[model samples]
Target: MDKKVTIYDLAKELNVSPATISRALNDHPSISLNTKKRIVSYAQRSGYRINKFAANLSKQKSNTIGVIVPKLNSYFMSSVLSGIEKVANGHNYNLIISQSLESENKEKLNTQTLYDSGVDALMVSLAFGTENYDHFALFRDQKIPLLFFDRVCHLPNCPTITIDNRKAGADATEHLIQNGCKNILHVGGHLKRNVYTDRFTGFKDALNKYGLEYKPSNFIETNLDAAKIEEIIDHLINSKEKFDGIFFANDAMAVACMQSLLKKGYRIPEDIKIIGFNNNPISEIIQPNLSTINYPGYELGVLAGQSIISHLNGNINIESAESILLKHELIARASSSSTN
Candidate 1:
């Protein structure tokens, strides 16, 4: 009575084999419906609890997927996690999620911990400070399915899921230019990450295409922290050339800077049209709705989950796996609309 109730105890009590109990519990199709119902009913009545560790040991599969993200506070990350959870749960796989808090050391530790925990597969969104990726080689060496989403890096045999950030960036910049924006300024994050770098590239390309001169002063490589909005506002206020349009790498920074610029008597659209990447919910809630690139976070997560699952089930060969690039859209709103 004191010990934990297991399938073996339930099997002996119900006069069935342990395999039948497991099959019934897992809803294996080979077991008859009536037999499954009976075994499940009796197991519930007997307080039987599945020992996943033991089952995993016998099957050589943990039936668990590990996920690592930069931070959990963003709406985009939450949506991605939700999509992944939906797909993983539908496949009867459990998730072990961890956040890196944007620290390289923390990300390394989390990766090692998840690998050591015997996860069947691993998914990651790299941290900003993660310059070294040697830590992830453990999963590659072990032949465990490894996937990257959002902020990804190239690793042999590891598939990546992400939107076309460069195109999205160009789309956002072009939208602003179409709305009559010239002398635009780009606010971005660390250029070490592809997302920010690609967006910046797209911005510059759009500027070049529009016959607008690209100047080093027109771009700001920031940390993208909302708390540092004042520094950006000061930069804008003190610039020799007044920017007619602004494009931010992410919505949070755009929204924060918009509020501050407004407080400083700058008018939206009329004074300086603004466009941001990642159509986060806050983009709509802000006073003058923000124009942004619609980065499909949920869809990216779903595809990542499906790809990993397919690889794990042997339905797809990981060695020949191709990286997935989701489409992005430019959403025009009051903040960047010429009509406003």
Candidate 2:
């Protein structure tokens, strides 16, 4: 097996002291530019790689950030991740990403692993079933910068970034009401999550503003699993009151509900109007384009990354538990057209 090249080899070949080589590699201001260039060129030619572990120990920084998400298969999540990676890479930082697969246990395990791996910072979008936040204590105890986006919780001194889910939800529901939907049903996810819970609050507020009676049967809380489409369909059909509009928490569920409604001989907008969140690609590809909120996931990710990096660089003091709300817009489409 071939031995890895080191700074010692570069120093020997360049006939310079190891201290001079180290200073040059680190770009110390005392070292002349020409000498630094020469050492860098020689190191490159010799295939010398700096030991990051030793550097991290010396500087007390790992130069790596940890990110945990619920899952990696969704288009929206992937888009956000791409934006985060772009920003992190531009700042010469490495990202260690993991998926929690919607389990709190898995999330806890991943958090511990990332901590042990010596990540300088951490970012998270909470898993579906994460109720206990004890796993994050290590990062807090060590004073590591921790940030949350999308699905977030209130943690002390940790900044969170997300759209105002309540306002967006109210806007979507109001749009349905404006389209002449008398009996609107809301299809949402677990209320334990801030996104869904706040959205539900907005849904009820809209109904109250319109002088409509808020009924318990008007809300259907699910995991937004496509496999539960049949159950949602049955629930809709079994409702005593006819549903003329639906506001889904996500585009995936909205698309699934649209398909099931069509299969049941109901025409979109003509018979029932629909709106969803996330503005996912499937929203446009469906037979009747789905009306949804443009959540700006990529922009959210970029902003989150920039905020954490700024905090890490001591450019900003993000000690308060502040929430950064991004703007959201309603995109009208065939699914919720008034003319239909």
Candidate 3:
């Protein structure tokens, strides 16, 4: 095997001090841009890999961030993560990412493992059943700068970043109502989560404001998984009243329900108009297209990353800020259009 190149080798080859190379590698602003680029290029060409353990030992920091999300295989989640990675990488920080598979037990376990691995900070989007947030106590106790996004709860000293899910929900419901969807139904996720609970609140608000009588049978609390499509179909089919509209908490569920409805001989807007959240890419590809809410996932991630970094560097007191709410917009489409 070829010899492993060290920083010293690159410094020797480039005629720069080891300290200069180190500063350049850490992306210190003090290092001249030209010199930093030269050092980094030589280091990469010479196969000099960073020894994070040694670096962490010297600086007393891992220069790494940990992230936990409900699922990784989603457009919205992936977009958010991409934004986080972009910001973290620009600042010379590595990210350790894990998924909870929407399980609270798995989320707790992942938290423990990430903490044990010595992450400098942690960002989490809570799991469906993570009502007990005690697992995050270790991070708080250690002052590790914990943050929550999307699905969250109140924990002292921890900052949260999310869109106004309640308003977004109300907008979706109101849009359907404006399109003449009288008997509206709302398919939401577990109310234990703030995201779902808040949206459900907004849904009820729109109904109340529009003078539509809310019916118990018009609401269904689901796991919001795509696999729940069959159950949704069964529920819609068995409903005593002929429902004219639905507002799904996420795009995947809405798309699934729409497909099932089309197969069952239902005209999308004529028989049942629909709206969904997240504005997922697949929403436009579906037959009638989906009307939905545009939640800025990537921007939310970027803000969350910048917030943690700011907190760690003393640039901002994120804990004092408590929460950051991003903007959301409603996108109208053929699925909810009465004229289409």
Candidate 4:
């Protein structure tokens, strides 16, 4: 086996002290820019990788942030991850991203693993099944920076990043009402999640503003699994009550139900106008483009990265930091167009 290169080897070859080589490689201000470039160039050519584990031991920091999301396959989650990676990389921080797969136990396990691995900070978008947040107590007790986005919960001194879901939800519902939808149906995910519950609340807010009675029969709460589109379609198709509009909690399920309804000879925006949340890429690709709430998932991720990094660097006190709420917009499309 070939021997791996180290800082001592670089210092021996470069005729400098190990401390000087370390400072140069780390781009310390005391090191000249020319020295830094020369050391960095030589280190790259010699395949001298930084020993992060040893470095973290000295600094008492992993230089790695832990992130937990419900699922990784969705466009919104992917976009958020991309943004987080971009920021984390620019700051010389690595991300340990894990998906809970919507299971509370899995989320708890991931939390424990990241904590055991000594992550500098933790960021989470809570899972649908996460009813209890006791798993995060270790981080809080240790004064580790913890931030939440998207599907968030109330935890003491933990800053959060998210759009105003309730307002966005109200905007989506109001758009439908303005377009002449009198009897509207709302399809949401698990109410345990703030994202789904807040959006549902917004839906009702709009309904009440226009004097439309809230009907329990008009609401459907599920896991929002696209594979189970049959259940949603069956309810919509066989409902005894009439519905002229629908507000879906997510773009994937909305697109799935829209396609299934189209196959059943339902004309979108003509027979039933629809609006979904998230504004995912598939929203535009659907036959009739889906009207949706622009949740800005990527922006949320970027802000989350910046906030946590700032806390870790002591530039901002996480203990005193307030939760960040990003702006959201309502997008109108063919799916919710008014026939009039």
The models' CA-based lDDT, in order, is: 0.90, 0.91, 0.91, 0.92
lDDT of 1 by residue, 45-164 (tens): 777778878987888789899999998878899989988998999998999999999899999999999988899999999999889999999998999999999898988998988998
Q: What is the lDDT of residue 291 in candidate 3?
A: 94
RMSD for each of the candidates: 2.5, 1.5, 3.9, 2.8
Query: Tens-digit lDDT track for model 2 on 1-340?
Result: 1578777888898898888999999899988999899999988877788988878888888889999999988988888888888899999999999999999999999999999999989999998889999999999999999998999999999999999999999999999999999899999988878999988999998999999899999999999897788888888888898999999999999999899899889999899999999999999999899999999888988988898889888887857556799999999999998963
Sorted by TM-score (best first), the order is 2, 1, 4, 3
Per-model TM values vs. the true structure? 0.91, 0.96, 0.87, 0.90
Best by lDDT: 4
Off by over 4 Å in 1: 7-44
- Pitting candidate 1 against candidate 4, the one with the higher TM-score is 1
TM for candidate 1 is: 0.91
lDDT of 4 by residue, 15-70 (tens): 88899899998789999888788888989989998888899889888889999998
Error of 3 at 239 (Å): 1.4
Which candidate ranks first by TM-score, i.e. highest? 2
- Backbone clash count for every predicted candidate, in the order shown: 0, 0, 0, 0
Q: Which window of ten consecutive residues has the lowest lDDT sum in model 1? A: 43-52
Residue pairs of candidate 1 with colliding backbone atoms: none
Clashing pairs in 2: none
Worst 10 contiguous positions by lDDT, candidate 3? 1-10
